[model samples]
Target: MARVRWWGTGLVVLVLLILGLVLPLVDKALGSGGTALAAGTVIAVGTERAGARPVTFTVPAAGWALDEARSSLTSNAEVTRGEVRVDLNLVIPLGSLDNRRLWDGLGRIVAMGGGRLPGGPSAVTTRHGTAGLTGPLAGHGKIGSATVFTKSDLGATVTASGPPDAYGRLAGEVRAMVLSVEISP
Candidate 1:
């Protein structure tokens, strides 16, 4: 009876150990796969221009994380929380590109990528006093906004999207993040 008890205890411990190891994997598979980023974390986006400051934005709320696999410093940066995702990209126009032209171009690019800008662009100013254009974005059963902030030859575009409910719940946070963008002189 003592030996049987020992064996049963060992089997239970082994099962528990296996569960402990496998549960997190299952959770990750079902949950967000990236590492979580704390609220208030400032993230630098885009490459630094010569003798110019690099652009950066703050994570306005908790539950966000940098999607490392889908992000690249030289090209673009993507961050996600739950179903919502925010993407930032730096644009350098080959010629003189006005805000409206840039916004239109970005819309075309979005359409090319199987997305659509359902609304026209409207003027918006970031908290840092940068001027930009913003409009509705929809694709892949998600809805959000696409905004472009320009300063001289350099421009930065921020796109945020998710399911309607999730996007609505996090709209303020997303707006805060977009407004928090800073393009230093």
Candidate 2:
């Protein structure tokens, strides 16, 4: 009986070791799968260019700009679908990212469709939205029903594809960041 028990323990240990070594590969394989790749590609577009002059994000509100903006990547995950978490702090300028109010965080407009606005000194129109995007490499869905944050601290969920459709959904980034912009009004 003791010998049998010893054999069982050995088998369990071997299986555990195999799983530990093999699971990572399996996860990687899945992560590289079409679905995950698509999702990641979609999300990365908006975030990747965050450093640009006007930082834009989408929230439930629709579209709005801030005086200033700051963003950070909190976490990211790969599964059947990809998921990424980014932390952000934005201040609406009296104008756009380049211009700012004399004070910070004061008079900052919380936008929905875009997080940070372009620093370029130009009158930009922020697009507000509440959309549901869905499709293959490129998604096609109703953007109105989707909400963005910049506008009114509202929540917007984006359901779209990545790449190709550059403006359509901002490459799957609309849902993650939906905020409103503040106008001179």
Candidate 3:
């Protein structure tokens, strides 16, 4: 009886030791329960076509995850970190719309959705010299910015927003991510 008790105790300890060592590794591989993405992860959106320019961007820091259910297309992606959310979409303009018009259209779309773009568009360029415009987004008790980059008929729009505090906290990283966006021709 004494020997059996010792063996059972040893087996239990071994199982616990193994679990302690393996759980962390599993968490890392699965992105902390298979939702969060590690920092510096590059995400690609859009399908490969003859003239389709795909958009790709990197996660600026930790605590971001791909919201798979909300992201249902090759031309769009949604990522979230806490209360902050960033959405990227690839669009084809219906007609020849200049940068300013595109920005206005985007603002109108936001307003239709019960949101508003409160400020004028500001020029922003990507790392690869893609010219774009960004403007302040407000309404629905959240604050953010909307940026649009265009090449020919292809357009990439990025919107990042969250509650005031969370938006402020992640604003820098979010901006970096936006600046890091690249549209492959």
Candidate 4:
């Protein structure tokens, strides 16, 4: 019994030592990793074949910033470049977590990335006598049930708008890259 108790005490001490040394490093590693991931995703989107001139944007209402830009094609078909800015707000279920909360989920996810508006300078480009976009977008929403749904589910209306045919297709990729991204909280 004495020997067994000694062994147990030794195990506990070893566990504590390991935890004390590891937790802080783990937290820091996670934070840095999140930053790198976000950066890479943004850069990739900026470089896509959508058009040219990549720019980043910041929206105060959404509490986030994203990189964006514009592009073009061989054909005279023009584009506006990056033309939309989104600001996201997060909300939680006020009533219950059941059906009521499920319904509340809409307001939250809809508010995800805040709201969209006429994008500003960096992302906008003038070509073919029209304006279009090809860039990155960054913003934040809230956490809670609504957030959960946004991550797990995104709707069609969330799709982007741009030129047509090839240029439009490329712009769609940029939008996909933007939406797929989720900054660390």
Give the top-scoring candidate (TM-score).
1
Better of 3 and 4 by TM-score: 3
For each candidate, the alpha-carbon lDDT, in order, equals: 0.86, 0.30, 0.84, 0.30
Worst 10 residues of 4 by lDDT: 70-79
Candidate 4 lDDT (Cα, 0 to 1): 0.30
Clashes of each: 0, 64, 1, 27
Better of 1 and 2 by TM-score: 1
Model 3 compared with the native: what TM-score? 0.77
lDDT, candidate 4, 1-185, per-residue tens: 35345888899989998799787788776542211122232321122235541222221122112322221111111112233222222223344333234333433544475732223212222221212222222233211111111212221111233333433434433443334333111
State the lDDT of candidate 2 residue by residue for 1-185, as single tens digits. 35345888899999998899888888887554332122223222122334432233323322222212221222121112123222223323344422222112211331233332222221223344322222121122212112212322211222222234333534334433432322111
Cα TM-score per model: 0.80, 0.29, 0.77, 0.22
The TM-score that candidate 4 achieves is 0.22
Instruction: Please tell me which predicted candidate would have the highest lDDT against the true structure.
Output: 1
Candidate 2 has its poorest 10 consecutive residues by lDDT at 136-145
Span of ten consecutive residues with least summed lDDT in model 1: 45-54
Candidate 1 at 73: error in angstroms?
Answer: 1.9
